[model samples]
Target: MRQLVRAAHIGPSLAVVALATLLAIADGLPAQRVLLVALAVLAGQLSVGWSNDLLDEARDRAVGRSDKPLASDAVARRTVLVACVLAVVAVVALSFACGWAAGAVHLAAVASAWGYNLGVKSTVWSWAPYAFSFGGLVVFVSLADSPPQWPPWWLPVVGALLGVAAHLLNVLPDLDDDERTGVRGLPHRLGARLIPRVAAAVLLAATLLLALGAGIGHPASLVGLAVVVVLTAAVLLGRGRVPFVAAVLIALTDVVLLLAAT
Candidate 1:
């Protein structure tokens, strides 16, 4: 059980579930539908987590990253593989239970990540998967409404841009190891000095779009603006872990703004 828990990367999965559930609630979805969407999100995030670990098992072992359950041999590779398949199946089934349109969007989101796991993560277009996946997620959740709603156009824009920033920040700490393992991606091409700058710029762009969508005088817009300025400053000027942590906090701020907008 503990091994399975580790294989599932429950911490991140829980975060996804929490965020999706909150979004559903913010959309005023019925409790039943909220539960369904949350379940689907949980399954999709699980698939992403397990597939990520499984696909990178060889590299994790090579890098001696024993903190990973697969690398430590605390979880069997076949077991993790089976869990991944099951989670994918669950995501498809539960997403469709919401609605056909919602299902398709959610599936595409998960598939984008799958594409990344397959090979896209090594390419210059690595940000594609993250953008599509995250943007499609907002679309999927909004589509779960009874009459089917579309979020503000800028919502998906913010989502996609933040997704790209996330990709950059995520790769920062592992840049050296990823290079050694032959994984370049977009962040690698930019190098360390420019990655944070790019992330800060993207985050600022996302917040600006949100401000325009939400109205400059709106409280949510004001808060997002403030967060954007502080975080962008930290990313551009701070060294060590400050930039990465700031980027994560900025993403959280976006999530809060999203919920407020809904």
Candidate 2:
């Protein structure tokens, strides 16, 4: 059980679930609708984590990451397969309950996640996975009612930027192992010296978008931008542990925005 939990990357998966739930609430979804949205997000997140572990099983073993359930032989391959299938089923079921637009977003999320696990994560456009995955979440939330409006378009723009920053930050710890194993994603292509700069740029763009969105009267939009600016400054100043801390801060900002908006 422990191994399975770890393999699912439960912490980050839950964080994504929380973010999706918040997004749903911010869009003024009903309680039942919000629950369905959260369920779909949770299942999608678990699917991503499980797929990552399954696809990178060999590489993880080669890197001596025996702490992983599969690498340590603590969980059977069939068990993992079953778990992935169940998660996907839950996502699909929840999407159907929500509506066709939500169902389509759910499918997009699953496809993007699978694409990332299969090979897109090792390419120069690795950030594509984050864009598609998070954008799907935004679409799901927006479509909970009527067709999405363009005035709130900055929401997805900020989300995509934050997602890309997350992708880069996530790859930081795995750079050496990834390169040794031929998994040179966008982060690897950019090199270490450039990571902070790229992170800064992404956060900056997100902040600008949020500020513009706020100027147009979306007060809740500035929450994430303020958090990103402070966090980006910390990262740029050479605080080694700031990236991980910033991630939590970013998540918190999303929570705050949701609370305020809802």
Candidate 3:
């Protein structure tokens, strides 16, 4: 069970689910609806994470990725495959329970992620899925409201920029392993040294967008922007895992400020 959980990429899956929960709270969704949204997001993320491991089994094994349960032979491939199938079914049902509009938007985000895991991760368009998925997430939540309206245009753009920053940061550590396995995604092509700089810049843009969207005149907006600038500076200058950690802090700051402003 533990191995299976790990193979599902529990950390990232839980992180996404947590974000969904926060968004649900921020959107003032009812208790039942918030539960449904959490479940749907959880299922969708599990499917994405599991399918990613399954698809990359060969590449992960080739690169000696013992951290990956499937690649490390800690769990049976068939087991994870079945789990992924179940998650897909659950996601579909739960998403629609939220409403047609929200369901469609959420499913699109999940499909974009699946697209990434399928093959786009190896292409220059690797960043595209992240952009679509994260932006779609915000829209999905907004559509869940009774009126089913779109979020402010800038919110989606902020989400997209954050998504891109996430992708660049995520790919940084695996550049060598990915290159060895012939996975030459955009970040890999950019090489390691440049990725942190790009990620910092992307994150900075996202921060600026959020601040502007929240109204620069707001004290919270100014404070949030200043904090993000400091964090992004750390992302650019910090070494080892420091940059990744700082980026996560920046993301959290952005989300909190977004909720407060909205």
Instruction: Check candidate 1 and list the clashing pairs.
Output: none
Tens-digit lDDT track for model 3 on 109-164? Answer: 99999999989999999999999998888888888777676889998888788788
lDDT of 2 by residue, 1-262 (tens): 7788788989889988888787777777789888888887888888889988998899999998877899889998888889998988887887777788768876787789789989998899899989777766776777765454222676776677778877887787789989988998899998876776687777667666656655626655655566666776665665566655665455456445534543
TM-score of each: 0.95, 0.88, 0.95
Candidate 3 minimal-lDDT segment of 10 residues: 253-262
Clashes of each: 0, 0, 0
Which parts of model 1 are misplaced by more than 4 Å? none
Superior candidate under lDDT, 1 versus 2: 1
RMSD (Cα, Å) of model 2:
2.8
TM-score of 2: 0.88
What TM-score should be assigned to candidate 1?
0.95
In the order shown, the candidates' Cα RMSDs to the true structure are: 1.5, 2.8, 1.5
